[model samples]
Target: NNKKGSNLYDYWGTDISDVLNQDESDLIVNLASNEYFKAIDKKTLKANVLNIVFKEKKGETYEVIGIYAKRARGLMVNYIIRNRLTSKELLKDFSDEGYRFNQKLSTGSSWVYLRG
Candidate 1:
């Protein structure tokens, strides 16, 4: 899963553009895949999905507090893939200074990291 260029589309079969273009409520109702979207609390799910769709509008950077692997894929797509940042660049920007990368996750899920 740490293969370079891997993204939400690769992990969840979800196209970021499609998710971004859809209405928020419509996305919430349609994105009910048990393998990925299941088991997430509704409020958190909505917030995460909306964050992906409207990230630019927020105009501020906030740390991803506690994202699971499935949720983290979307964020990787938003903050990494969409912005065309290489892994090295990501490390340069977010590593050290109290930000750690994949501190305690299994290898298979280590590609995702927390900013704070």
Candidate 2:
């Protein structure tokens, strides 16, 4: 008998890594769950990853709600697919589901989206 963890990344890491490496485009939009995204070893990937994070504004503070963030992520994927985004610059035009890019809160590799 053989045994392995039930983690998707642990099981399919090589496949994921292969696909990413095959792509000539080195731009990766990582909107996946931390667990699933962890399947690919970044050091092995030929692409540069841009992690998108969603947060909700509450008065003077901001918070990350997993469910809402997940929903927003899905919406963003739909938008990207529908619009056929070819560059990271197009990401700033995302204003769906009441979310927009927060430039002040964003970094070069990590983008932050805020919603009320």
Candidate 3:
């Protein structure tokens, strides 16, 4: 994930703190403080996350929703929804650059099938 920058690092730290201990009063008083409450295009968000997953593993599209980044190698991420095809289609395909339109067009398919 290209989420490796100073701004992202700082922003995530702040975001987590705000979410972890938020109360009803905080929610009502500091609506703007809830970064997660900020409007975001769900379609674009899903697409971007899927694109990142596809890059790491070709033909493997993951639907990610919320993500929590801690000061560790592992990140706590959530998926928007679970797709049955992910594991089956991802085992053989490896897209180091993630999923791209060109690749889909060249392959003449949107999602691919593969053997486990």
Candidate 4:
């Protein structure tokens, strides 16, 4: 089931130009969703997860294309990418036990792939 008022939906198929300019703390809070990210302490989450925001050049301006977060999981890695720019082949390369490239959260301009 999907939760309402979560940024998860906003992160999909939406331009994140403003989000890219935000501070690290604000960025994490903005991107956090109830579905996957349920941590109450933002500082703790920030310290634990490795976050990366991606951008792409669209004609003249650069647009925020994706957000990636990863945390250590013993020998493996737990990660998620809200992707609007990666090709299917490249996405496949990132697949792991928790997430498959084909098992995306949504269709169209963007997709959310989570691995836990």
Candidate 5:
């Protein structure tokens, strides 16, 4: 729970689990719907998970999950899923608002990946 934000948090993975619940090995995954990653309005990207990929950490010998795509429009859907520690090195030079608005918008979404 985020007392500052006054709301329940929605972060996933080992880092949060380790620092917040140090002894717990349970992984907290925040699965988003398919449409969440697609282009919509300015507010859409703020509410979805764009993409995920393993990345190396900077100045360290480890890895961390990076969820840095804050918003987008078109080809801007390219997000990196790397170690939280080394994420900045890869995305530091990339702008978050560089995607061209997609011409063919997708609708009527359906369920694909099912997880627990």
Candidate 6:
């Protein structure tokens, strides 16, 4: 957790905003954990940030197991680096470590992946 009364936006909001506003697709695929990425002030960013959630299906429910979820996030980063994937569509091709994209459970900005 962040130190008491410490806020990310107060430290690096402008830098993050500038990066997002640069001449790239106005999309930010936020893979950072909730605590760390909060350093960026969303209002200042011109990019549309896409957040992905990973889950495991348990009987009648879906849940994120912390350790496995961390592994899954790393695997996804590995896949991106290895494949040089730029298009969001390529994200659907991710199957490393047994996770699969779940289209039926995804929304416009948030994508979900599941493994069971």
lDDT of 6 by residue, 1-116 (tens): 55533565665747867776885786787777767777777877777888877898889888987778788888888888899988888998888877888999988888889988
> Per-residue alpha-carbon lDDT of model 2 for 16-109, expressed as tens digits?
7788889899799999977678888787888899999999998898888889889988998999999999999899889998898999999999
For model 4, the superposed segments whose C-alpha errors exceed 4 Å read 1-89, 103-106, 112-116
**lDDT by residue for model 5 over 1-116, one digit each (tens)?**
55433422323223333343443323222223224422223231222222322223345542322342222212122443432323323432333433222213311221111111
List per-candidate RMSD values in Å.
15.8, 1.9, 16.7, 15.0, 17.2, 3.3
Q: Which candidate number maximizes TM-score?
A: 2
Backbone collisions counted per model = 0, 0, 7, 0, 8, 0
Query: Which of the predicted structures, 2 or 5, would earn the higher TM-score when compared with the native?
Result: 2
lDDT tens readout by residue for model 4, 7-82:
5533432223333334354222123333444334333332223232222345775444333332212112233344
Clashing pairs in 2: none
Model 4 TM = 0.23
Displacement of residue 37 (Cα, Å) in model 6 is 1.7
Score residue 77 of candidate 6 by CA lDDT: 87
What Cα-based lDDT does every candidate model obtain? 0.36, 0.87, 0.27, 0.35, 0.29, 0.81
TM-score of each: 0.25, 0.89, 0.15, 0.23, 0.19, 0.84
> Candidate 5 at 79: error in angstroms?
2.5
User: Who is ahead in lDDT, 2 or 3?
Assistant: 2
Candidate order, lDDT descending = 2, 6, 1, 4, 5, 3
Which parts of model 6 have CA positions greater than 4 angstroms off?
1-6
Model 3 misplaced regions, further than 4 Å: 1-7, 23-116
**What order do candidates take by TM-score, descending?**
2, 6, 1, 4, 5, 3
Q: lDDT value for candidate 4?
A: 0.35
**Model 6, residue 97: displacement in angstroms?**
1.3
- Residue 19 error for model 2, in Å? 1.2
Query: lDDT of candidate 3 vs native?
Result: 0.27
Model 5 clash pairs are 53-81, 55-82, 58-86, 64-82, 64-83, 64-84, 74-100, 76-99
